[model samples]
Target: MELPKVGSIGEYIRQQRQQAKISLRQLAAQAGVSNPYLSQVERGLRKPSAEILNQIAKGLHISAQALYVQAGLIEDREPDSDVLAAIRADVTITERQRQVLIDIYESFRKENRAGNPEAQPTQPAEPPPDAAVHRENTATPDSKEG
Candidate 1:
């Protein structure tokens, strides 16, 4: 797939922030960035780092992977289903929750693929070691969210 122009990332970020009804200053604050820097980034005067993009994604209540795709840090690919897209696009869920849902979805997919050898691998998706910890932790009310 063709990637978006580098300059469009700024526009994407600005658009997401606006859609969230956040002012420039408020978004900057939420992203733990300086207002001037974020303003520069929004206007395409400055390129933001990946870390900044992640923070901006968090502040905008959007997907970091989506932002990464827009920024060309990652290749864009169609999701397997609307359910996956909806999970990524959901604004009400926390990032951790989104990840958990995705993990479960991926596990199901792996189970299906294992049953049928004809299914091709799209990528080498390795679950993080801490994913098990997350599953275990979620079962306990006292577990602190990272």
Candidate 2:
């Protein structure tokens, strides 16, 4: 079969989507665009605005610059390094706190293994051996002859 050309931004969206092996309906759902509009765009009958292009780019898991390049808006540029750096910086968690959280999570997992429902009411702790209950008869004790 002859391959379709990647001619415009819309065509690029369709091409990338096909390359990713995602159905047009799935892409439309992910991009929050209607199926008919996506089809029209893919056929080059409609051109989406930059904001919509960004949505398409996000749905395709690609940078907007790549889409712009494919649309003949500008030459291709490398992905933004600052975006990654900012993400790494935003995850400012300390190792100690992370380990503590992991330990607490594992403890809860153990409770789950012991058949505890997540929101069930808990029972009180068992009493100590010395604190065990005992029963006594009300009648007087029998006396034995020595």
Candidate 3:
């Protein structure tokens, strides 16, 4: 996919901010960025980092992934399901909390796929050393407890 121009992304952000009925100064304050920096970003004179984009997304009450796609940090793919969209759009939860929910949802999907008999088996990957050690430590009987 062709990457969107930085100016286009900036324009998109400007449009979103306007559509949300938020002033540039208010957005910058909410996003925890300086007014001049935000102005530069809106003018396409500055490219924002992922962290800044996340803050801006939160301020705009939108998904960070949407901004990431517009910034060309990620490829624009198929639209998310209504459930996933709702999860991402929820403003009451922190970003970390949203991510945790998404992780759990994806894990359940993977588990469901694994149970399907028609699914092709893939080669198992080696577990990380820390995970291996954790399993071993939990599996062993506590000799000291007795």
Candidate 4:
């Protein structure tokens, strides 16, 4: 697999931190690193170790595996399911809560699949072609309403 370009991981980290609305000094304090070190990492002036990456991940409330993949320390795997992505993206939930929900969801999906050997996995069904037309026909303008 092609390796990520230099500073890509730093860019990813910066993006995540911004998305999380965390300050550099706050992150550094949480990750137990110096502010200058974290700044250097973000600027690609320094390459952080895996352990430091893990600490930063914890500080950002994200998975270390995600950072590892971004840093090209690990291979990117299959994309997560919509449900898994939703759970992981929810900032209101704690990391432990997210893991528990994901585990439960996967277990239920596995059980459902196991019960029916020939059943296909569920995907969203497309709306019928005429559905939009029907809605347009039924919808009334303000002037037409009683």
Report the number of the highest-TM-score candidate: 4
Rank by TM-score, highest first. Answer: 4, 1, 3, 2
lDDT tens readout by residue for model 1, 42-81: 8877788999999998898777987897677887465457
Candidate 4, residues 1-146, lDDT tens digits: the string is 65344666787788778877899999999999999999988988778899999999999998898789777788645455778767655656655677789889878878777886555467789998777753356555865867
TM of each candidate vs. truth: 0.52, 0.45, 0.51, 0.59
Identify the runs in model 4 with alpha carbons over 4 angstroms from their true place: 1-5, 79-132, 135-146
lDDT for model 4: 0.80
The local distance difference test score of model 1 is 0.79
Number of clashes in every candidate structure? 0, 0, 0, 0
Q: Which tens-of-lDDT digit does each residue in 1-146 have in candidate 3?
A: 64344555677678778867899999999999999999888888788999999999999887788789778788645355566667655655655576688778777767767897655457799887678443355544756575
lDDT of 2 by residue, 27-138 (tens): 8898899999888889887777777788887787766765665566765332354533233223244323434554575577568778888734468888788996678855
lDDT of every predicted structure (CA atoms): 0.79, 0.66, 0.77, 0.80
Which window of 10 residues has the lowest lDDT sum in candidate 4? 131-140
Error (Å) of candidate 4 at residue 116 is 3.3
Model 3 alpha-carbon drift over 4 Å, by segment:
1-5, 79-146
In candidate 1, where is summed lDDT lowest over 10 consecutive residues? 133-142
Residue 109, model 4: lDDT of 79
Q: lDDT winner among the candidates?
A: 4
